[model samples]
Target: MTETFDLSALKQSLDAAPDHKNLKPLGLQTIYLGRDALTVLPDVVAAMVDATPALGPVAVLSDSTPKRYHAGDLLSFVTGCIDARHRVRNVTVGVAGHTVHADEETLAKAIRDCDGAACLVAVGSGTVSDIGKAVAAAQGIGYIIVQTANSVNGYADDRSVLLINGVKRTIPTRWADVLIVDTDVLVKAPVEMNVSGFADLIATFTAPADWYLATLLGMDDSYSPTVVGLARNQGSALLEAAPLVPQADPNALEQVAKTLTLSGISMGIAGTTAPCSGMEHAVSHLLEMATTKAGNETALHGAQVGVTTIVAALLWQRVLGEIADGGLSRVRVPGPAESQAAVLAAFHTVDPSGAMGAECWRDYERKLARWAHASERIELAKRDWPTHEGTLRHLLATPQSLVAALQSAGAPLRFADLEPSVNEADARWAVANCHLMRERFSIADMANFLGIWDDDLVDELIADAAALGSSR
Candidate 1:
């Protein structure tokens, strides 16, 4: 039987864990989930006011897009709600754009401008919420999230994926003190947005395998089954609700929202994004960077992640096949100089000025150093590949399964299906160069270090993914 997740019960378990004392406080105090969740806005504000009696003005941060409901403007709606009860001044910080970026300049300006605000209530989706969290952390103020859409899992996470020096980096940030998910509001969001949210949650099926692989290779020591299992526990439910997402069914929207929120909390518990982001996320980030550098609009983060998740699943299947065929015994670790040269050369194609390349190497070198120091663990992984094969397979969904899930949710399952339309060449470029773009060690890194991911293998994986897409 599949396990059911109760956030309150899970929080209690986390608090009671023997290592709980060492764990950083998630800072998430309350979650208001249901229809009429917006009604609790005053209560959230009052709680913050009680905690910080001398709290300054409250800033409501949001994008310019209007929600598809009777109360269309999320920021206006929130401001009006807070104005009715609290005498605290509420200021609206509207980031100019339908889609705002989580970059250093934007965040710095938001933080500098909202310096005196004692509380921040994010009134949009993932990007707005992430900006609010970052600004709150910078200003040392409490934060709350009034989610307008089920778009991504960053809502409850303590980390923000910000662009630093043109490369996407997952930086530690603050979690919201309260998270409000109103199903009525979520159901009014664009169906595509809801589908993208479902797609993001689907990554739970594949990301944990990458995390487990990194643990086995000793590249990351912060792996936890408790945290990872929390997300996995909701997998079957999310998949069951996937087909109804396109219709904006309230039940389905609530299920997706709750699961995605739980996913962010899982990241908080693990103190890393590794539990929900892996090689697939690297692929999405690479594609986003390419589009941004080319002066084009990027696709939805979760949409890109969905398509890339299929690719990662296929690559893992192939890697496991190779191991089953005695490939692990033939694995050869590369020298530091060789790995650095490869990373640099791979990155030069993405950025000719070498700045991005240097930034990537700065991070990748740490993983390489860790791998060198943990040579014994590497040997153990090689010798134990067969023993852990079943567990790895269990953690991943098949390519066909991912494709069907994306299709059911009306998400982009292929490059051509993406918004802004990623072509075959760019998608291939992302698959090939994704490992070099991040310091994190994923299946891509493992494949590259083992000499398993080459031009021919990339072509094979691309062909396999394309076939899966066509089969849909």
Candidate 2:
């Protein structure tokens, strides 16, 4: 028997899913946080159709990979779900990427091809949703995300991460006004992918501490822990039910859908990725950019982030421990000149082999140059990290239900398992060079701020990390 999901929140979320809490819509958005909602696609569509004319002429844009996994059937399924009083003028699902191999041009063109799409429905996971959201945002249209898998937490995020010329980039895009998830499909998604999501969700614990650290330094902290707790709790519940998620059982479906929906809403609440990312996310972004360059689709985003989580978690622990030992002085963030020199030097050494194509590196430089001018005054590389490091340790070190869930679902336990090529050197190098990408200070800069950031230090750090690595 399938474990049943607690879907009591669907009614409330549906009635108010469109805008901010203060700008709630009136019965226009609908959500199905239950098992096999996809299989009952007809009902899903019917519920949507009757919800509002605003979504009836919805243009469905998706990457081909998710479409192959039944993303296209969603509109037809929803068409069947609605009452005869509701009418769907037509459901047009325009193919964006091929086999999830989406490109920037394809992503941009998909939105331009919206034709009669009044609102867009994203049918896949991260990649598909990114493309769909960008199109909607550029067109100033509303979007609904129908997640086919629990592979990411950007369902309701206003920003989308994209690959522009094989480089990872974050773009401001429209967030989903409505997030619809069918548990059956998510539980039955590729095992590695689901495990990856498990890792990403758990990283939330570590992420908020980093956010808090920045907030103390004067970054905005309007996001609430209460909203983040919703997703975190749901994620924990799903992890507890990890074994059942991949069984394609109804109970597992509900849990998967609930967690996924909660993740989406958390983005809505935070208005940022504070509820879902941190140094782990930063590391995965680097790996993903490299992977795209190598023509290697090695692992899912969550899987890579999972491996990075432990590394960041350990670094946070050690930094705090050192502070407790009273062996290190509190760090004042380096002056811009000093920090920039360190960042540039680290990137060169890490990229010595030129694994990243020249064109890609050139493009990155151009983008960074453009962004730096406006962001230079922000004092972006924060140095007072040990205190926040202690907080991150509290969040990442504890054995949460997420670790158990990913293990139950057969997710990776360590970096070696995910990237045999990633050695102690690679881990250290990635952390050391982490500064060039984001305008934020994370574990990478924290490691650099500490005196133990040499090759030998990095090696020692990785060795200790590998030794204490947990597959549980």
lDDT of 2 by residue, 1-472 (tens): 1223333454365444443353212222445555454454444444544554554365665543432234545445544443343434332233434235346777766756774545556677787787777877776666667777777777656678876555466666766656666654565477656656666776776676666544554433444545555557665577666776556565665665556656656665455665667777877777666555555554677777766666666666666566555523544344555545554554554354443334244433543443334222224423444554555555564433334545676666566777434544455656555545665545554455555555675566556555555524
Lowest summed lDDT over 10 consecutive residues: which window, candidate 1? 1-10
Model 1, residue 120: distance off in Å is: 1.0
Total clashing pairs in model 2:
11
lDDT of 1 by residue, 1-472 (tens): 1112355777788788765763455667778888777887887787786788555677778777777545576666788888776644443344446357777778887888677776778888788788888888988888998888888998988888887777888888888888888888888898888888888877888899999888887888777777777767678899899889999898898889888988898888788888899999999998887777676788888999998898899889877877788765666767878877877787677678877778888888887778667668867877767778878888889888899989988898788888878988888888998887776789887787667888888878878887888887
Model 1 CA deviation exceeding 4 Å by range: 1-8, 15-24, 53-55, 86-98
lDDT to native, each model = 0.81, 0.57
RMSD of each: 2.9, 6.5
Candidate 2 — which residues are off by over 4 angstroms? 1-28, 36-58, 66-103, 164-166, 219-223, 246-248, 326-328, 345-394, 399-405, 419-428, 470-472
Model 1 clashing residue pairs (backbone): none
Whole-model lDDT, candidate 2? 0.57
Query: What's the true lDDT of residue 455 in model 2?
Result: 67
